[model samples]
Target: MTATRVCALSELEQDSAIRVEVEGVAMAVVLDSAGEVHAIGDVCTHGDISLAEGFVDGDTLECWAHGSAFSLRTGQPLNLPAYEPVPVFAVTIDGDDVLIDPAVKKAV
Candidate 1:
């Protein structure tokens, strides 16, 4: 499958995350503090809470419901209550557009 255009790069604020869905897969598109874009599964592995609503600190996204921080680059859970790693998708930036492929899980 080809990468789907999620949103414009300009639409994302630095150090923030946006919720998007690609091919029925919920995703959290994050712009880290260093201005790098990352795509991870939106749902927390420990619960049904949305990771998009979590806090972005450096390269990790902290789940708001259980304070479980997941690495934005690898989707590995960094704290308790979540022992499993979330899926990290491939993210590509083309011009001003942000593209993501839910079918492709990025290598950790």
Candidate 2:
């Protein structure tokens, strides 16, 4: 599997997320309160808008389109308006760099 470099670990803040595009796929890289990294498709399942534009709190990514929240860890739709789960990538921290595996499939 090829791992694409996303950003530096220091670039991500705790409980915050960032947007990045890899291989023509928009992705949201999130850092939870516990300092764990997660990668999910930037698009919301229910809408064409990007999930990176939404608000992220704790482990849930709140879609700004219709307030559908999805789990960052499992890519499960936690609320209504988004019955489908977004694609999730695998995240790896190498030294100070953040890498993501786009080949990883998202969970529902």
Off by over 4 Å in 1: none
Per-prediction TM-score? 0.98, 0.92
**Model 1 clashing residue pairs (backbone):** none
Query: For residues 1-108, what per-residue lDDT tens digits would candidate 1 score against the true structure?
Result: 899999999999998899999989999999999999999999999999999999999999999988999999899999899999999998999999999989999987
Those runs of model 2 whose alpha carbons end farther than 4 Å from true positions after fitting are 106-108
Query: Which candidate number has the best lDDT?
Result: 1
Give the lowest summed-lDDT range of ten residues in model 1. 99-108
Question: Among all windows of ten consecutive residues in candidate 2, which has the lowest summed lDDT?
Answer: 99-108
* C-alpha RMSD of candidate 2: 1.7
